[model samples]
Target: MGTWDIGPFDNDTAADFSYRVDEAPDGERADVLLAAFREVTGTGDEYLDADLAMEAIASAALLAAQCPGGEPVTTSYGPKKPLGVLPGELRPPAVAALDRILAADSELLELWEESGADEWKAGVLRLREVLTGA
Candidate 1:
């Protein structure tokens, strides 16, 4: 496969971002954790080297540590309720699991940017759902 440019953040056009964010205006850093986790999980193309995956995970952790808000991504679940504020039958157990994860990590809080970390966090949950075959 060829290389892919993830592109750096530019405030003038940040509104067009598809997903992810960093606490500061420097868009170059946002979503490192997500990328790292993706690497850990070995996202996409089976040929991705295991060592690269490990390195990516390491890099992600470092970036997350440097996070301006000191959080990876905000959990959507509320204290006493499940996430997905829709009028339908919610997955009680899934909601509970997500809630637990959120509660355990106060540092996972996220900043509000247009389609910011919330979207990234959702992607994370989606990955878990798929992996667990939920």
Candidate 2:
């Protein structure tokens, strides 16, 4: 997985995803994020792979950063280009994608559990809380 930490952009896949987002045109940046989230939420109960989960988590972090209480994504691995304010509509799908990533069949979830990553799990939950504004 090439993961070094629990942050959304801490891994190679997510770092690559950040570049992808940066390369996207300003008007289409939100679409890029939406696509990542949908890749997980649209998979239903299928086993979610780590890379997909990573991208979705990155996307959610970007969206959440725009919320009132949400923290900004200041990591170097996060997108270099500013995404501007994403639409409020993205929140629901971002939450759904997070749910899917934490679900039983998700490879990312299993990997974290096997590694006894309580902090990682908590970070994901924090992302969810930011997304839902709870």
Candidate 3:
């Protein structure tokens, strides 16, 4: 929950997630990203934890980096090694996770709303647009 900026990898949970991605076997990094996305998307009607949301955001950022017009993840806190070409299949779930995070029950959204960080929300929206090529 130690968020220092609006970027996906700026928070402690997401920074830790980047390490998980870096440490995962090359073929398993996408699994790590999928798990993060599913954790948020599968939350259903339950309150979505901010940490989970952060990890999902980080996951989406990594995937989005490979898309056309997507910015490369340059944060030092992001994965150090290249993630290889991620599956295009991940985009749908990444967008779903983002939608869930922006939903009313998301703790991350609540926190950002309280903090008046419209840019954070906007960043998440931009990620969605990138994933959907909208």
Candidate 4:
């Protein structure tokens, strides 16, 4: 996927958060970025539109980078809300696109060293757990 500019969504706050996430390195910085995205996007609610879905998927891909093999993290709890409700046929390709984005970005994983953002990191990890199925 090409670089996404923040369009008119939630008074442009979504764009700001997305940009931050895009710029963040791995570890705590990335975790904070993801948390900010979730907070600004209000992703916890149901009925995610396409733009929000893409944002959530991108965040998920970033979180997946921290996990080994980039596979979904298995967890004991289920997802609270649908991350992005894509059509059945489109879901696979969308996920593939996000994975490609993650793969192409080397700096994301390279900066995964500890940064003392434990709370934010745990928040992103919890979202990952929900996304992947715990």
Candidate 5:
């Protein structure tokens, strides 16, 4: 019914390993962010941790704005045949997934908005690339 808090897991970049179904980026912090990302996105089959997610989202802010143009970069897929209209059987999952991801993202955005953390806000915007599979 709530979210999970998987603590700072040791990231081993030397080896290739994926802890979840979604693909994580090269950054260790990004990987941690994705863990929460999946949880918030419900892309994974479980709850997501809050602290770790905060940490990753925070870290991304330190990096340069990778994409200086476009609305935003995303990879997450919603329905296609009827895209925004939602599908018939898989409609629930598609809608749910998008909701989860957006909600998790919203949490961070709201926080940065309140704190006026411009760097974190920038990172949140960049998160589109990581959160969305597009």
Candidate 6:
């Protein structure tokens, strides 16, 4: 259960509050990573406004890209659960946010490639496509 504190962001309420990554549960690495992304970006709950949701998506992308090996290591305050299936209301905003983040951050794409997170990236892409198409 090792942990790494990445850094604090302006969205965070406390200066000491930071994004962190922790070891994944068995057979749940991808879901854990996704959850981590949402948690770190402030989108883990149902209370987010559209703006915060967008920020969360961008932050998640940044974390995924910056993550070493692109594995699921991010952690937050809560019981571990699968994030592969997001609520319907969140899909549209998540897609838009991801698109915005991807468009703005070439480095994240490069990091996704470099980290060999093909499956994770593909899943995200699929989610984006589905949300956009719907």
Q: 26 in model 4: Cα distance from truth in Å?
A: 9.4
Supply candidate 6's per-residue lDDT for 61: 39
List candidate 6 stretches off by more than 4 Å. Answer: 1-89, 104-106
| C-alpha root-mean-square deviation, each candidate | 16.4, 0.9, 0.9, 15.2, 12.6, 11.7
Q: For residues 36-134, what per-residue lDDT tens digits would candidate 3 score against the true structure?
A: 999998989999999999999999999999999799999899999889999999999999999999998989999999999689988999999999993
Model 6 vs. true fold: TM? 0.33
lDDT per residue for candidate 6 within 17-96, as digits (tens), equals 22222244444434433453354344332333433333344334333432333334233432233434333444444554
CA lDDT of each candidate? 0.30, 0.92, 0.93, 0.37, 0.32, 0.39
TM-score of each: 0.22, 0.97, 0.97, 0.30, 0.29, 0.33
Model 5 steric clash total: 8
Candidate 4, residue 29: how far the Cα is off, in Å: 3.2
Question: What is the number of residue pairs that collide in model 3?
Answer: 0
Model 1 segments more than 4 A misplaced: 1-100, 111-115
Highest-scoring model, lDDT: 3
- In candidate 4, residue 112 scores what lDDT? 26
RMSD, candidate 1, Å: 16.4
Alpha carbon lDDT of residue 72, candidate 1? 32
> 1-134 in candidate 2: lDDT tens per residue?
79999899999999999999999998899999999999998888788899999999999989988997898899999988889879999999999999999888999999989988799989999999988983
**Could you say which candidate leads in TM-score?**
3
Q: Quick one: ranking by lDDT, best first?
A: 3, 2, 6, 4, 5, 1
> Between 2 and 3, whose TM-score is larger?
3
Alpha carbon lDDT at 81, candidate 2:
82
RMSD of 2: 0.9
**Per-residue lDDT tens digits of candidate 5, residues 1-134?**
02122111212210112232124323343334334334445435444344434433322221112223323212222101111211123223322433443354444345445656465444444444433332
Worst 10 residues of 6 by lDDT: 1-10
Off by over 4 Å in 3: none
